[model samples]
Target: MTTFDGLPPLRDVIQTHGLVAKKSLGQNFLLDLNLTSKIARLAGDLTKCDVLEVGPGPGGLTRGLLAEGARKVLAVEKDSRAMGPLSEISDVYPGRLEVINADALDINPLEQLTAPVRIVSNLPYNVGTELLIRWLTPPTWPPYWASLTLMFQREVANRIVAKPGNKTYGRLAILSQWRTTPRLVLELPPEAFSPPPKVHSAVVHFEALEKPRFEADAKVLERIVAAGFNQRRKMLRASLKGVKPEIEDDLRAAGIKPTDRAEQVSLEGWCALAREIAKT
Candidate 1:
């Protein structure tokens, strides 16, 4: 069996290499190169920059990245079984794709990657949210990556781009909206993946902002938001009590009602509240 491209079909490659999808690694191998290509194109002009792909199982998306004229692709795959197939892609692309057999979480792109990079991956389910948070809230502004085109469980995707008042809106919505403009580009059904995960999946594209949407201490905002949403059922007055001695005063100064819930506050409101908390 051959794929749309000249290479052997991904299913054949998987069988040949005995690359069974491992539940522990959160692997649901994407077997369709065409679908992968669509995801690659969603990242915009890949020719201008390098791409960092996580969990490149059998290199389907890896091949898509390289095929779409990405200057280079640094694909990190923890599954040792994929080395052979990924090596085949490396061989064909020759220096265009570098397969690093390591954990994506441990790789700091700032130290290891070049400028004008884009992170594109069908991220392993187990670590997808963790990795996205890292990318969303980098220590430095104007992160190394030019953009992030990632696939996440639809529920997580909704939360990341969810706006105030949306049921899915929560910490992820606030955190993601603060620093990046995220858009849901594509929604893929479960059948799109080989193992067919129980839930649907979607691709989200995030454009990194030159600066945060508003001004506030990063740590203060993080702490304040965590507390505000700590017991979401509780109103701000109760939830934020421990954040300051005069929590109600802080809320009033920020123009937020003490009775309001976290989901009711806008990004500007959160930043304002963070500044008020800092006054204590």
Candidate 2:
């Protein structure tokens, strides 16, 4: 029944510490403990796993992760204002929680935690997509964490789970689905936050595959996907001009139509195209 090991309610913690959400930091405090707990639960059983959290405004989600039985919680917060509030949680959990007063972008939280880790966070809006992409394209396969449970602007959630031929489908869908199975788990209206964002938000879960769904150099695949979607309305033969002229033969060999647009190409199709381009 204790909240965050014994730290006070997030609101009181924030006020007592004079912590205000700074627009420059892309902070929108989630004060609803119930909602934060919901996000922690969405990460499945954390009894034995380490958890990494980013932009933990007032430690709402951080507390939930620890309370849900995470063996350890490494919280990276860029805002100096939240340190005092988070310190309270650290004292409550003692050795169970570690708070880093650093920007999520600068630190590799995964490397700092033990294996069998799950990254669960209500990410800062400005850096959410960039962070997700970094995790998805880690130099090695089976990157540090087992899965990612992240909150994003609802539009971004759509992109992560978008399928080929859907309007929402594009580079993000192509890249994400190529390496992980992403699913939308929950949605929150703007009202969920102390200062509501203009747009709705959603939590998307990504379970990284041992190997990619298809084979191709990650770099090459990224290039091809970016080129294809850069001019999405154009035909593949036209959109992929940067991929060498001989790419058409490979496309045909892979059973992809040269006239197809980027939106019409599946993740598998993109992999096939990248493999073809890699040969040249």
Candidate 3:
């Protein structure tokens, strides 16, 4: 039994099930139960929350979430080989764990998750950024999850909680901060994983706000932000010129200078610009 959850130790489980982290699937299994539990704790109280976890490779974090008293966990695992190890976890946790063998991007987690959902995952590197974008850009406010606790490559993690004028600041920071309060909670070295990815990893915890921090049309905001950051080195006048015919006027109205670069604009300023551009 493992000390963290009283299930088998992860290394034993891995050897028993022949669970090798598949590079093709972007798998670098985090085998430390203690660390996984710590990551789960970062999600706050999970006793009543349904956790939606993606890429539960070998079920390390799955066990942690269950042990941490998550009301229920909907674990989406694309690798079928992991089902054996995951099944053993489900048996231990009983009804609290549900395993879905499918691509997380292909399925809608809301269909399986109950309200007050907390999305917690040691996300696969290949799909982490894409998944975060999808979660942040959902059609309506508050989307489906109450909070998001996800691990990403350190570089990507920095982008999530970055602020204006930072080199990492851009679309991710703006989009993340516009709707949720994101904080970088923990950092892990490469040695923390089974395969040990070359780069370090970090966990980001995001608490969803009832409403966007600032009001703006989602589509308009997305469009202009994309344009500005797509050519981040260029001044807004040059980069966002294609977004709206009267780009300079809109920038001024938003209290931003047309000469400002994308990274120079604050979230509030970007939202203001989105609103200004939407008026046209």
Candidate 4:
């Protein structure tokens, strides 16, 4: 009845706790220990790092993180039903796992986790992108976590690592690549989850850079990127005309063609444009 980690198999835990995946909260539990453990391993050398796990339904990935030697795990679960099962995990791990029965979106996990942290989660689909943006654009540079190993829908994963000229490229791509090295590490079929989601999912690993890849004002860069992609089909000169009094001039000054569309511009090009626009 027990798995290699000495914890009961996730199904047994779910059954014992009467856990049911709630679609409204974006819960889709990964029942396979080996798969979850593999995901934990992808985070790399967790022995010294405190890990943050969101929505630890039935503690599948939670157990993975502990078994793989994470120094400690702060698991934030929104569903009250999960607290009981997760507490059981906390009992087994003995001070290694801390479960917070609150929405991951509301609280600052850094308050509970220690230094040299890494965030590893099979993020609930609903708030995954929003949480990623919050992490990507924290108030200061070199935010708490040194790395992020997260799971998202395949479409989103592609967008995170998408390159200029790819249809998937947009604000998300710019933000992800601007200050971090993001790569698609693994892919999963829908059947992997307890109540399979409608789409395939993938894991992405992001290592934070000491500084942004290029020098540009963060606020200005975000404004430019958002405006540029808001009307991605229009030429930069037209799409960004409202951004400033003379955006075409700024675009040319940045070495960007006035006729180029948003998807045609690289991250460096966007930085250049942001820098140029900031001058006016």
Candidate 5:
């Protein structure tokens, strides 16, 4: 049977291209076009925006994004096996799809796409968090993408949107919330993929903020957060030893109690401390 877009089923696409899930590449092909389209829709109206996709194995999510009215799609695939299938998608969509045969980690996708882009993908598990951090901390304000709709392991998704005092909250939570408003949009059981992963997956939507939620030097903020969470069990005075000898006074000036532990402090509190440190 044909899919909604009249293309052959994804399993056929995978088999035709000899695309097997490569554990080394962190591949788990999603055969369900319906689920892929749902992920596409979560990116909202794609009629006017370019979509950036990472790890489009057998072009499952690529097909969905094109069919759902993406003005253009720039799909980066590392595994050469999936290129044949993605090439087929490029033909189906004509000028609307551009397949880049390169590692997602090696390429700067923002440099290739037009402005007002939205990244939508089922990211490769091994590098998903690293990619998210790159996007969240691009060197300049008003980042290349307008929003991000990406899938990750359930645990990673929780960390991205976690709030203060939540067990999942940590470096990811601080980095994500500092620059964007992230939401948990969809949850999929392990069975959603061809070879079911041991952990469930989730899709997250992150809309970039026009202005950062707080003001601090990005480098300083990272340093402060890393110090605080690296030794989360310790008091600020002890945990921030790497920061400066006067770090305790700095924390106090930021209105964060010196006695508070890392997890107990809010994102704003971290930013406040970062701002103080930057002044030193």
Candidate 6:
């Protein structure tokens, strides 16, 4: 079937280019144009938005973003095999889609793209979580991108938007929820991709907030969250021992009981703990 963007079908593109998914690179190409369009719409209005799409194997989602009215899309792919197919997309879109041959992990979009930007990608599994943390851990508030619409294995998706008391809640939960509002937009079976993965995948949208829930040093907050949840099963008094010497005093100052586990602490409590730890 012809796609809305008038490009060749994805399977044909893959076959023509011998673009088999790479296991070591965590590549799984989503050939379904309908689903890609669905993810594009979840980023809200994109008419004026410049999108940063990582791992666009065969340009399926890259086409979707353009079809959904994105002003421009910078498609970053590590593999050189896609250069031909993505080039076809750029010719059709005419300056709307720019293909960058590089590692998404090493490129910082904040320095590359203009404002009103959104990052949308069906991230390669190997680097997906690490990329999310990088986006979430920007040095300053009101990060460059307006939002992040990403796909990941369902397990990691659950951890991103997980609530404080949920079993999935941990450092990811605190880091994600503290800085942005993340919600699951769509869930797909493992069979959704060209070479289906072993587990299911889901798309999540994280809208950037103007500020975190409270003021705390980004590095300090990250350290505190990591330490608190490092031994989540242990009480705060024990788990946070290595983070700061006065663990009990920090917990008390945060209005939290030393016996509380990491999962039981709220965002507010974590911020307070961060501040307390900074009280040197």
Which ten contiguous residues of candidate 1 have the minimum total lDDT? 106-115
1-280 per-residue lDDT for model 6 (tens digits)? 7668778899999999999999988999998898888899998899998999999999888888999999999889999999999999999989788888999888766665778999999999999999999999877788888899999999999998888799999888888888899999899998889799999999999999998878788898899789878898999899888887778987898899999999998888899888888987
Model 1 per-residue lDDT tens digits across residues 190-226:
9988899999999999998999999988889998898
Q: In candidate 2, which residue pairs get closer than 3 Å at backbone N, Cα or C atoms, i.e. clash? A: none
Candidate 5 — number of clashing residue pairs? Answer: 0
- TM-scores of the candidates are 0.97, 0.96, 0.98, 0.98, 0.98, 0.97
The per-model lDDT (C-alpha) reads 0.90, 0.88, 0.93, 0.93, 0.90, 0.90
Query: Model 6: how far is 232 from its true place, Å?
Result: 1.3
Clashing residue pair totals per candidate (backbone < 3 A): 0, 0, 0, 0, 0, 0
Query: Tens digits of per-residue lDDT for model 4 on 188-219?
Result: 99999989999999999999999999999999
Root-mean-square deviation per candidate: 1.2, 1.5, 1.0, 0.8, 0.9, 1.1
Tens digits of per-residue lDDT for model 2, 1-280: 3464566787787889988888888888899888899999999999999999999988999989988999999989988888888888888788988889998888766557998999999999999999999989898998888999999999999999998879999988877888889999999999999789999999999998999999988999998888888998899888887777776787897679999988988888888877877876
Q: How good is model 2 by TM-score?
A: 0.96
Q: After superposition, how far is residue 65 of candidate 4 from its true place, in Å?
A: 0.6
lDDT of 3 by residue, 53-94 (tens): 999989989999998999999999999989999998999889
- Tell me which residue pairs clash in candidate 4: none
